[model samples]
Target: MTSSLMRKGSRPLRLPLLIAALAFSGAAAHAEDEPGSLPRSFPVATPAVAALPAAPTLGADIAGLLEQARASNPGFAAQRAETAAARERTDSAGALPDPNFQVELMDFTNQMRGGGTTLVPGRVGETRYRVIQALPGWGKRDLQTRSAAAKAEQAAAGLDAAWLDLALTIKQAWLRYYAADREAALARESLALLGGLEEATLARYRQGLVPQQAVLRAQREITTQRIAQVGIGQRRRGAAAALNGILARSPDAPLAAPAEPAALPSALDLPALIARARAANPAITADERGIDAARLERERTFADRYPDYSVGVTNNRARGENQTWDVMFEVMIPLQQSARRAREREATQMLAAADARREATASRLAGELGSAWSTFTSAQETRRLIRGTLLPQAQATRDASRAAFETGRVDFDAVLEAERQLVDTRTSLLQAEIEARTALFEIEKLVGETP
Candidate 1:
C-alpha cells in the first residue's frame, strides 16, 4: 500500500513585473490549509518528498524579464519606432507650404503693346522675377496643426497600448510555462508513487492474499501513465519554447519553472474593476485618441473649403533704361465645389465611424472585463472547494482504503478505485489552480493591474 500522498507546499512566488504599470500590482500569496476540512483518512507512513530549491523571488525575476523584453522584443521595438516616426511627421504636417521664387529670361525681346507709350529695350537681357507666398484660408493652418497634433497623440496612445499588450503577452506565456512545469512535476511524482503501490500489490499477490489480476492491473496502469508522461513532457517543452520566444530568446533556451502566484482574491469588486478597465485600458484609450484625431480631421476638411490667397513682389527689367518693382496678389478659388463637398462628406462620415468605433470598443472592453471577472471568481471558488474540501477527503479515502487492503479487510478493487479517485481529484485541483491564475491574469490585463 502507498502510505501517503505528497501535498503541494511550494512557496508562492511574488511577481512584481506589473508594478511599473499600476500601484495595486504586487505578488499574490496562496491560501492557508485548514486541516479538519480534509476528509476522514488515516496517515500512511511514506518517505518525505524530495527537496526542491527555494524558487527565486518572483517579483525580481518578472520585473527583470519585462525589462529585457521591453528592450529586446522585436515587435514592440517596431511599434515604438513607428510611434517615433509618427511624432516626427507632426511638424511637417502642420507647416505652411513653402514659398516660391522664380526668375525667367527671354532669349529675344519682342515688341510690346502698351496703352500709351512705345516700349524699347536697350540691351537683350529681358528679365522677370517673382517671389510668391500662399496664405491659406482663415483657420486652415490652425486646423492643420490641431489635426497633426491629434494624430501624434493617437500614435502615442497606440504605442502605450502596445506596450501594455506586450506585458500581458509576457504574463500569459509565463503563466502557461509555470503551469506546464508544475503539471510535469506532479506527473513524475505520481508515477514514482505508483511504482511503490505496484510493489506493495505484488508482495500481497505473492503471499496469495490478492489475485494475479491486481499485479497485472498495476502494470497496465503504469504503462498508461508512461504514455501520459510523454505527453506532459512535450507540453512542458512547448510551453518553455513559447515563453522563450516572448522574451526574445533562442527557441531552446532553458527555463526553470517559475513560482506560482497565490490564489485569486475570493472577492473582487467587479464594479470597481470595470471602472478601472474603462479608465485605464489601453485599447479604450487608443480609441478615444483616435476619435479626437478623426474629429480634428473633420474640422480640417471644413477649413479647406475656402480659397487661398497668394501675394508676392515681382520685378521685370530691361538692361538699362526701364525697371519696375510691383506688388502682386493672386487668389485660388475653390472651383471644384462638388468634389470638395464629397471630401467633406467623406471626412464627416469617417468622423462618425470613428465615434461609433469608440463606443463599440468601450462596450467590448466592458464585456471582456465582465467575462474575466466571472472566470476569476468561478476559478477562485473551485480551487477553494477543491483544496479546502475535495483534496483532503480524497486523500483520506485513499489512505483508509490502502490501509484496509493491507490488512486484508477490503478488496483490491476498493484500493484501486480509491487510488484513481485520489489521482483524478489531485489532477483536478491542479487544473483549478491554473484556471484561477489564468483568470486573474486576464483580469489584470483588462484592468491594467495585477495583484
Candidate 2:
C-alpha cells in the first residue's frame, strides 16, 4: 500500500512538470512570432532626413562666459578674499611681541606730610618706570614667517583650483546648451518632412493607391517628433538656467544661444599631460605648499624646546636730586617637557600627513588625466566614424527609399524607417562631439593651459 501511494504522488508531480514545459514552449514560440522581435540584420533603406538650417550666429562665447563667472561667482569671490587674508597674515607672522610698560610708586605716603598719600610722581618718595621686550627662541621667528608664507601660497593655489572648477562647469553647460539646441532644430526639420509625407500619403489614399493606415502613421510620427521637440526645448532651458546661476544672475534670465564648441586636437599627449598636471594642477600645488608649511611648523615646534628671553630697562626718580638707571633680564623656563614632547610629536605627524597627502593628490590627478585622455580619444574616433561613414550611408539609404516610395515600388513604412535611422545617426554624432569636447575640458581643468 505504501508503494502504491508513492507511485500515485510521482504521477501527479510529472503531470505538473509536463504542463509547465508545454507552457514555456508555447510562450517561446509566441515570442518568436511577435512583430517587435529583434532582426539579425538592420533594415538599410528608409526615408530622407531633412537637412537643418544653419543656426543663428548670435551667441555667447565660452571665453566670455568664463570671464563673467570668475568675476561674478560668489563662491569664487570668497576664495579670493581668503587668499588675500592669508597674504596679510604673512606680513605679521614674524613680528616681535608687544613690549610691556610698568610704573611703580615706591612710597605713595610721605612721612614729612604726616602719612598723607601723594598723587604727583614728582612729589612721591620714589618712582620707577620700566619697559620690557620679549624675544622668541633663536630661529623660531624665521620658521614661523616661512610657515605663514607657505600657507599663503597654498591659499593662492586653492583659489586657482576654484577658478578651474568654475571654468569647467561653464564649459559643460555651454556644451549641453549647444547639443539641446541642435536636437531641437533637428526635430523641427523632421516634423516638416513628416508633414510633407502626410500630404503625399493623403493624396495616395484619395486615389486608392495607399491605405488610410499610411496617412495615420505619418501623423503619429509627427506627434512623436513634436513631443521630443518639447523635451529638447526643456533641456535647453535647463542648461541656460544653470549657466545663469553660475554667473550669479537670476535663474530665469534669458541667454543668447551658445556658440559652437572649439574643435579638439587630432592627437593628445597623455604622458605630457600627466607631467603638466603634476607640475601645475592647483590642487596638487596646494598640497605641496601644505607640506612645506608643515615642515616649517615642525621645525618651529622643535625650537620651542629652547628658552625665550626678555630684556628690560628701568629709570628711578626720587624726591631729592638723585637719579638712577637699572637694567633687567629674564628667561622663560621650558619646564613642561611632557607637553612639549607631545606637541613635537604632533607636529612631526602633521608633517608626515601633509607629505602623504601631496603624494596621494599627485597619484589621483594622474589617474584622472589618464581616464579623461582615454575618453577623449574614444569619443574622437566615434565621432569620426559616424560623420565619415554612418551619416553618409544613412542619407543615401533615406534618399533611395523616399524615391522608391514616390514610384510606388516601396511601402510607406520603408520611408519612415529610413528617416528614423538618419535621425538616430545624427544624434549619435552629436553625442560623440559633446563627449569629446567635455573630455577635453576635463583635461584642461586637470593640467592647466600653457601660459
Best by lDDT: 2
Any idea what lDDT model 2 has?
0.88
Best model number under TM-score:
2
Model 2 Cα lDDT, one tens digit per residue, 1-451: 5564356536534657868999998787767654765453555454599999665332367877777787888999999999999999998999999999999887788775355797777777888999999999999899989999999999999999988888898889888888999898888888888888888888888999889899889999999999999899999999988888888988887677776665679979999999999988999889999999999999999999999999999999977868899999999999999999999999999999999999998899999999999999999999999999999999999999988988899999999999999999999998998899999999999996621
**Candidate 1 lDDT over residue span 69-123, tens digit each:** 8888999899999888888877887677899997765434443422232233333
lDDT score at residue 197, model 2, on the 0-100 scale: 83
Model 1 steric clash pairs: 14-59, 16-59, 29-262, 39-392, 39-393
Instruction: Name the TM-score of candidate 2.
Output: 0.82
TM-score of each: 0.80, 0.82
Q: Ten-residue segment with the worst summed lDDT in candidate 1? A: 25-34
